[model samples]
Target: MSNKQPESPDSAEIFERITYLSGKAQQMLLDFWTRQEAPAALTGDPFGMTSLWPAMTNAALSDPLRLAQMQFDYMQQAAGLWQGFLSGDVPEGAEGGAVRDKRFGSEAWASAPAFQFIKQAYLLTSRYIMESVGALEGLSPREQEKARFFTQQFVDALSPSNYALTNPDVLKATIDSGGENLLRGTEHLLDDLQRGRMKMTDESAFEVGVNVAATPGKVIFENRLFQLIQYAPATETAYEVPVLIFPPWINKFYILDLTPEKSFIRWCTQQGLTVYVVSWKNADETLADVELDHYVREGFLTAIDKAIENTAAPAVHVIGYCVAGTSLAAVLALMEERGDGAKVRSATFFTAQVDFEDAGDLKLFVEDSENASFYGELSEGRGYLDGRYMATTFNMLRANDLIWNYVVNNYLLGKDYFPFDLLFWNSDATNVPAKWHAAYLRDLYRDNLLAEPGGISIDGTAIDLSTVKTPTYIQAGKEDHIAPLRSVWKLTRHFAGPIRFTLAGSGHIAGVVNPPAVEKYQHWTLEGTLPETLAEFQDAATEHKGSWWPDWLNWITPLSGEQKPAPQPGEGKLDALEDAPGRYVKERIA
Candidate 1:
């Protein structure tokens, strides 16, 4: 520690520094807007709900009594807060102002009369707006979801936590630092603007193939859609039947291979198995014609073909995650139709949805024709769904964590984010092909056809889930927002084979990526007959303490055939294209 005291910046100096930051931020934004590849015109509505105003308005007015009751309730709550302030006592119960969100948990928010009033007033109004709009009658389920999602977004933006004056912690930070905090915050703002994405972690602290995604492997094959990486085995010998994994294309595959301690790829390699993973291409106009069929054939099927070739194995164990899991189901169905189902030994799905019913908040973005049209125009020129849109929508799903929390920490409190591997992977986004984007949202999410027999066709072959009798294992997150647990459980009903389904203890990312070394989460399994509904599954589930990776390995080892000498890369028909954490995974969205 230095003996010299640090200089405290004065108000005037802080103001000048802030002014410089503002100018820098403006220039950075201008530079970004003037990029050669910037969108030429306003492509599509970001909110995509400007056209729904009339219908929403009519629905609100249709229940005048309900609207009036909402107003009465809000005013009544406001009056209670005012009375408590006048009496110099903070109310602290259900009848009082409710600070339901964790943002206002500080003592200042509850102890100060003025702060208490401001907090309660904001809460009351937010509740009124959300409940009134969300509960409006006569709108279809899709319309209702759109209204709820967009309205919550509007409400979240107005949070007092985002403002320095309204936020108690920000005010304290400004005071203790003599306004230097705001100046630093301004600089952070300018930096984020230049980078074109919000700063969520210490980006410089980690890099692909160095610290994260450091698992040793070799890219044995490449195609226009994806590159297949065959990991170097950690064990002396491996399973006779190799395993292949297909991660979602919406984001990079590195999430599963984040670190030596956390990488599922590394763990699998150590458990005496030959593993091959598909690293999807970051699509652009050059791949315009690439659609769902290409992804199913060139991406999933091609990876399987390569894996089988590398090991000269009769069949391979297949795993798919998120959107990839959805595509994998179709690929299996297609394989069955083609008499090629024998190529797969078994299948595993990680939070993948085969059934789209009650798919949750994401339905808001795709359930309407106008929203689909908006996305079409957004992707028409580019020939792919922009990564920014996907990242933004996912961020909105948990705005409090992914959006506002960072705004308060990085822009209000002026603190640098701690190094986090997952958030870094999240910042690295990927684009979806235009044709695939349209078909996914329309045929599955909107039409709900994939779950219905003969209701959907893939590459001219109608996919029947019942015919997909490949022995299956499925794992889902208990609190998953993207692919609800219930929807994942619905897969057990469709597949005509023995299935083992398990539920982990966290949300989507945390649940699926947990490593046994950390022992951070637990998973549940059923003792007997597989059930049709999530409720039944839960009732019969036996809770297992710790990561589910070990259980998965135990179940799969039996199906893996006997262990044998590990097969080295380039020992088969295809030679190593490159080292592991291959080139395609390194491509970032422009």
Candidate 2:
């Protein structure tokens, strides 16, 4: 009876409900229309999907028969694979088998035909997509680059090894460990999340000045921006002209003096050469306004003056690594303008690029609009680019080796992190001042300014690489993704003095840190002037089996003056404050 009475009295309530429903429906229709009318920019097709789809559609329509034939061929191959699996007969081209990638070498994946089929399908699809993207037309170079990058991201994300459920090895481990591995993996993930970055290496395993950067030296000069270290000489007499190394401020300077056996500084001191390294401060909010000029006048030049005073050397042989090399070129140009070029005897650049035209995949992130916005936001409150941001970007450049490998081991398989020294150094990144980082990206990367005359200025004096007349020695790595060999080769066009360019084996760090005793990788050397093109130079060079360190010593020995009694630590106005691997290198940012 109550229900009937309520129903009878609900006319006004029904009208109100109808009105509300109609309003919602009308708003939904309006929203649909608005979405349909939205601009492409607001639609957020960040992967260049709009361009990719049209190109793909056009290609497929233009050659339907070819597409069908390719699909049919794939099916046939897949069927044959299944047949071989049932017969226990390995397929042709199966010497290394379907699991050619060493990353998937586990018996769980390698011995199983189903997993092998999955791997093969993945590889074929990835190859096809890459080939298609490479052949894409009607898109700008930037768009093409974006397309390729995103395609790679998709391919990498789809790898079976990324998913615990998909990866047989991970599944087996999970079963064997009775789910403890999963718990450990979850713990690792949570720990990394709390830390705001991945742990690429076992950081706690190595301590600065203890097991890792244990090379013998003394911090002779300390400034707000840098601490200059004068290594204790291992030889009775040292070269009259000292060698001052300006390592890239992006990382700790001890990379040059990591372990005694692998330390470049140790090698130099043992060779009867006075070694001085500038350990740059890892900038924080306080040093946010630090500019390129500060790095020049305050950091490098000050170190140069101190080195001269300490060793009583007339001039110093300057060596710069990575971005330090770029700064060195600018410093020399400024010195030339100031009539102080005489202070620098010669210049050597390690894996450094004066011309940023082909700075490799690193340029991609700087070029991306989305990444640019993120960078802008990243520097807003921080006033400096976090070391983790730079570290993540660098790791992405070699995603397979640097990123996914660690992901699988640390997260999926729940294996402890490797205690590799190089990985440790890589993860131990340093922050860069927002102002300086912005300028570097704008001038060198975006504008390609450093390569051109009057493209940039320091202390109101325009920096021209052509004006830097110091005899130069440039070393580039053959497999260096960070600083491509061709990009470094462009340095030859800017310098007026005689150039000695060497192409070493391995990558950015390993190539330079190669010790002769290891006898691991080879290097290439060419006599006379470097050819205009990288290809020509590579063609003309002769390959030598062994480290480039010895060759470099021989090359720079002449430039170093006559041997004299070794100089004492902090002999000049500067006094030794602490041992090698000083406070600056140990400083960390939260």
Best candidate per TM-score, number? Answer: 1
Clashing pairs in 1: none
Off by over 4 Å in 1: 1-48, 94-100, 367-372
Whole-model lDDT per candidate? 0.84, 0.80
If scored against the real structure, what TM-score would every candidate get? 0.92, 0.87
Instruction: Write model 1 residue lDDT over 1-590, tens digit each, in one string.
Output: 77999887777886676567557656765765576365522444544666667779999999899889888887887787788778987466422334466777788887767777777777767878888987799887667878888888888889887898899998888767755677677678767766657888998888988998889888889988888888888999999999899899898988999978889999999899898888889988878888787888777887888788778899999999998998899899999999999999999999999889878888777745544666776685778888877898899899988899989999888997799899889998898887788778888987889999988887898889989999899999999989988888888888997898989999899999899888787999986678667888888788988899998898898999888999887677889878988888888764
Compared with the true structure, model 2 gives a TM-score of 0.87
Worst 10 residues of 2 by lDDT: 38-47
